[model samples]
Target chain A: MIEARGLTKRYGGKVAVDNLSFTVRPGVVTGFLGPNGAGKSTTMRMILGLDRPTRGTVLVDGRRYRDLASPARHVGALLESRAIHTGRSAQDHLLALAHTHGIPRRRVDEVIDLVGLRDVARKRAGGFSLGMGQRLGIASAMLGDPGTLVLDEPVNGLDPEGVRWIRDLLRGLAAEGRTILLSSHLMSEMAMTATNLIVVGRGRLIQETSVEEFVRGASGNRVHVRSPQAGELAELAAREGATVTYSAALAGASSAAAASTFEGAPGSEADAIEVAGLPSERIGELARAYGIALYELTPRLASLEEAFMDITRDAVEFNTAAPATSEGTR
Target chain B: MNETHDRQSRDRAPAASALPTPAAAASSRQPGTATLERGASARSRRGSAAARAGDAPSGAIAGDVTQARVMRSEWTKLRSLRSTQWTMGLAVLLLIGLALPLCVSASENWTVADVQAGSQDPVYQSLAGLLLAQVAVGVLGVLTMTGEYATGMIRATLGLVPRRLPVLWAKAAVLAGVTFVAMLVASLVSFLIGQAILGSHDVGVSLSSDGAARAILGAAFYLTAIALLGLTLGALIRHTAGAVTALLGAVLGLPLIFSMFGERLESAQRYLPALLGNAISSTSPARLTDLVSPGRAFVMLCLYIAVLGAASAYVLTRRDV
Candidate 1:
């Protein structure tokens, strides 16, 4: 288990990680989700004691990482793939690290085979591809048979097959009652592999929740309806305790005159409404009672990617302005 | 905590069931399961040993990171690099190779003025190659520390041993120990060969002669001291080109720069590393009045190393990796 409390790291004038706190428990993979410059790497460094926090404490299994005896045996970390010396061979690199804690040479060979790097184990690491470098990093992390694995961007350079392999590897390690903390900028990847997420934006915690709850909470049971009398149906749904909004394309044209013209209009393709806090079945029934010709009634569960973007939009470090045409309608 | 655990278990069930195919494929295609099993067995053995110890609250294992282990790790790292072999080999070569020419020419052109002026003191003349060989040894020492920073390997190294001082101490110990041994052998071989050549001209001194053994051994000691200075500078500067420049400027350039000031800085010149090294390695009676005693020069070199070592240790622990 890993615990970070009031973890703050400031580089000169800029604060990288600000008062961040979280707990990573055993038996599950916790996805550290953030934007590109949201201090995920810095926070991980602080946890591993690579960088000293400005004012905070990060403990692994109730002790500071430096204070832990044989820290590699308890917490194995792969901070960056390029941490190995380029001139050293993969086998020798792992052996050098293993020698620190007196891990046997046999263990080094085992990890080399485990990571599927046996073919290039004796070649200089400088010549390995990015995927191979990541494999070597993982191999070194596993050399101590650690119980806690902290991996930063583990899938950055892997092929599709290698990505699948990492997912399975993390799952298997977590299944063995180990704590696995993996960081990524993509929510779709975490949606597949991680059970819990600690989302950060602009060096601050935005939310910490289970993936199911985050998806469910962000989706909010929204329903989508397309109809000839969409404007009237929107008014009815809004009056019935559902928050109704016109779709971006149709919102500009949803005046009273257009609503009246759309009523009984057979081929009005641009009339649609998004109804939150109501199910599609309820919206369909309401449309039938109002005699509105319902064209499409579909329950829309927001994609995890969209949910992540919506929550972190303001906190995005390099946000671009919305298009001028859509700005007035939204 | 209990609620979190319950939620975790509930969450893990679906995740575990969702990836049956990939997990099975991974195991079938790779040596995944057996490796994990072996890891589990090793962990169990370590866990049992920790339990038996009963004294370590942090589950300290038997072979946890120690000074000795770090030293051993440093030895592996030092020997595994091809640069280490090249730099050390070059140092030995220059130590003995350059000595041959200097000793041959000095013996062949021996004259009455050279003997009167004490320029033909066989011990100092034979060990003249130390000037160039010290450069190679110093470069090796600087690379020992700066190589990690240049390649981004310091992260892996510091992560392995979070209590970082042991790494610095181990590097120092290993470099000092190895350089001392190698340079000593080179010095001995150079001294013996140079003396044999000088003996043909009836100007050679035996090992038992006054100050002869001291001069030979002192050359190795002076070179060892230069290696430590290189390491200390490397730690302080951390960049390869910058640290090497700083090391060379201090060791070789200081003496030349001081010479341009004439007799105004004559007293200060003797404290420079190059001058101190020359004093320790020279047995010429004619230059005795201008140079410090060998013992005093040795003490001054130690003082320099001690101060630099303390600064390095202080900076190493406080700075972030």
Candidate 2:
């Protein structure tokens, strides 16, 4: 398990990681989700004791990382895929780390084959492609067969197959009762692999929840009804306690006159409407009762990416268009 | 039907069922139940077996990151790099190559009365390569630390041993040991070859002669000290070009810069690395009255390393990787 309490880091006047606390438990892949510059890497660095925390403590297996008799045996971290000497071969690099804790040479070879890097193990790491470099890094992290794994952007340079490979690897490690904390900006990836998620935005804790709870908690579970009688159905759904909004494309799809021709029409073009707090079945039944020819009635569960955006909307550090209050200096 | 079943299982299993078995976990296939369980069980088996075999300190792969292990790691690191071989090879070559030709020419000139007019101190004449080889040794030392920072390997390194100081100590110990052994052999070989070439000339000095052994050994000592100084500098200035520039400038530049102060500061220049290098490599005492004793020069080199070493250790622990 990895526990960070009140961890804070500041670079000059800029805060990289603010007061934050979280526990990464074993038997699950805990996804550390954040947008770019969200301080995910900084927090991981503090956990590994690579960066001194300005004001708090982080412990791996209930002791500070430095205090562990053999840190690699308890905590294996891949902070950066290319955090290796390019001049050395993959085998030598793993061996060097293994020698630090007296980990046997066979373990190094084992990890090399485990990561499917046996073929290129003897070549200089400088020549490896990004995918190969990431493989070598994963190999190093697994060299000690540690009880915990912390990987940052593990799939950044991986192919589709490699991405699937890492998801499986992390899950397998977690199943062996190891705490797995993997960080990524890709929410969909995290949704697939992470059992629990600790999400941050602009260096502050936004939420910590299971992937299922996170998706379920997003506000807009809505049904989209596309029909020539959308105007009448939107009114009928609104009267039944569903929130209705005109789909912008509706006006362009059919005709402007067909929409604005009716005063107080819910839909602009009278072709489509979005109804929230109502199931597609109910919307379809309502259209049937009104004898409205419905072409499409589909429930749209918010994508994980959309849910992430909604959760981090206030906390996003980089927004293309400035919202309000002029907080860009951050 | 198969795709539907796969998607149904994936959607129904929740987080716990996502774990694959060992056979499917061999990094060959897409995520499957067999792969997750196989990978998990295989690791557990290996983990417990290895732990029971005493390869690790605990039932898990646990052992203290001791100083000895770190030193061995540094040895592996020092040897694995191609630059290590190139720089060390150049140092050895420069030491012996320059000594052979220069000593032979010096011996040939001793026969001519006009040639005898040249400075004929055999020890200093024979070890001319010591001057150039110090550069090579210093570069090796500088690169040893800076290379990690350059490639970002330092993050991985310190992540494994977060106590931090052990790394510096190990690196210094390994580099110093290697430099001492390699440079000492070079110095001794050069001296023997120089003496062989000199062959009974007035300037010829045997290993038994006064200060002859001290001079040869001190050359190695001086080179090792320079290497430590380079390491200390490399730690302080983590960039390769910058650290090497700073090392070369400090070692080679300070003497000339100090000498510009002229006679009043002449005595002070003896304490500088280059001057100390010269004194340690000489067979005779300092010709200048103000120059320090050879024994004192050796101590001065150690003092430089000590001060830099302390500063390096301090910066290393306090700074972010």
Candidate 3:
């Protein structure tokens, strides 16, 4: 189990990681989703005890990382793939880390094979491609047979096959009841692999929810409606607690124009129409009240990226929080 | 799937410690909180547990990353580096292979009367290679620590071993060991070759000889000390060009530069590393006991290394990676 309670880190006047808190429980892959420079790497570094938290603390298995005996055995972290020395071979690097905790060299070989780095384990890390470097990093992380794995952007430089392999590997590890916290900029990857997500923006926790709940919550469930009176309908919809957009109006107008031009059949892009935020039934009632015929009414569920953007557009501002304020009150 | 089975122990933050305080803390928080009630309840739950564990003294560092392990790791890292091998090889070849031979032939070609007129002291005269060999040793020493920073390997090194002092200490330990060994071998080789070339003059100095042993031994110690000073400077600078410039300037530059400033400059110049190093290798059975002895020079060398090493440790431990 990995838990961070009010963890914060600061660099000069910049708050690299704000007052953030969350738990990554075992038996599930908790995806750490954030925009670029959103403190994902900083948070991971703090968890591994590489960067000290200015305030609060992160614990792996009921103890701070440095406090744990054989820290690698308790928590395996790959904060950056470039952490390995380029002069050493893949196997040598893993062997050296494994030796630190009395872990057998056999485990090093096993991980190399596991990561499909066996083909190049003996070759200098200097010669390996970025994908190979990531594989070597993953191999080293697994060398200690750690209980909690923290991987930051593990799929950053992998091939399509390598990406799929890692997805399956994460699932397998979580299935075995290990705590897995992986960070990624890719929302689609997180959607496929994560059971739980702790979304962060500008170093503060935005939301921590199950994938299903987060997607649904951010989606907001507003249906799209169109009319020539889109501004009026949007204002009406906004007052009614529904979010509306201009794209739906364009869709409705395109449909209206298509019907007029081609034998009473509506195309998807009729012009001179407004898109309303109300449900289809409600839009019909309102359209009838306004005496404006509805050209198009479509139920739209926002994509994960859209929801992500909507939430984080407000969140990036938190990245500019005072360094002193970032130090967790906890 | 089996979340409940992974029940972890109570651990919150380093700030929390003990049961009574935890109980008090839990109660201290408003039982019925306002808007943040959910997060508040979770905090109380975990904070109380953390207090209990922390109140009891935390266990010793897991595996206890002792100075020994750090030293071993540093030794392995330093020795395994290709730079370490290349530099050590350079020190030996330049000091023993090239400089010793050049000086040996130069002294051999000189007439007996001319040699006697030209020489100030045999102890200083026999160890001419010491001057030339220092460059190689200094270069080797500087690279021992700064090379990691240059290659961006310092990040990986610090990540594996987070405690900064240990990493610095380990590098110093390895530097001392490697420099000592290489300096020792180079000194012995230079000594024998110098003696071989001086065969006709019959000013033979053997390792078994009394005053001969001290000069030979002192020369070895002096070179090693000079190298360590370079290592310390490299660590302090943490940049390859900066370290090399500083080290060379300290050893060779100061003396030559000071000589140009006349006797007044040369008088204070004795305090420089090479002067103190020369004081160490200076030999005379009766006179050695007085003036600047090998013992004093060795201590002075240690003092230099200690001050620089301490500076490296302090800066390293405090700076964020």
Candidate 1 overall Cα lDDT vs. reference? 0.80
RMSD of 1: 7.1
> Candidate 1 falls in which docking quality class?
acceptable
First chain of candidate 3, TM-score: 0.79
In the predicted model 1, the residue pairs found to clash are none
TM-score, second chain, candidate 1 = 0.82
Off by over 4 Å in 2: A224-233, A236-273, A277-299, A317-330, B1-23, B26-58, B108-119, B200-202, B286-290
Per-model TM-score of chain B: 0.82, 0.80, 0.73
Model 3 lDDT per residue over A132-217, tens place: 98888877676556668999999999888788767767665554456789998888888777778899987889999977677666
Q: Comparing 1 and 3 by TM-score, which wins?
A: 1
Interface RMSD for all numbered candidates: 7.4, 7.7, 12.9
Indicate which candidate wins on DockQ: 1
Residue A228 in candidate 3, Cα distance off native in Å: 19
- If ranked by lDDT, best first, what sequence of candidates would result? 1, 2, 3
Task: Report the candidate with higher lDDT, 1 versus 3.
Answer: 1
The DockQ assigned to candidate 2 is 0.33
Model 3 achieves a DockQ score of: 0.10
Q: Which 10 consecutive residues of model 2 chain A have the lowest summed lDDT? A: A319-328
Each candidate structure's TM-score, on Cα atoms with residue i matched to residue i, is 0.84, 0.84, 0.77
True contacts kept of each: 0.46, 0.55, 0.11
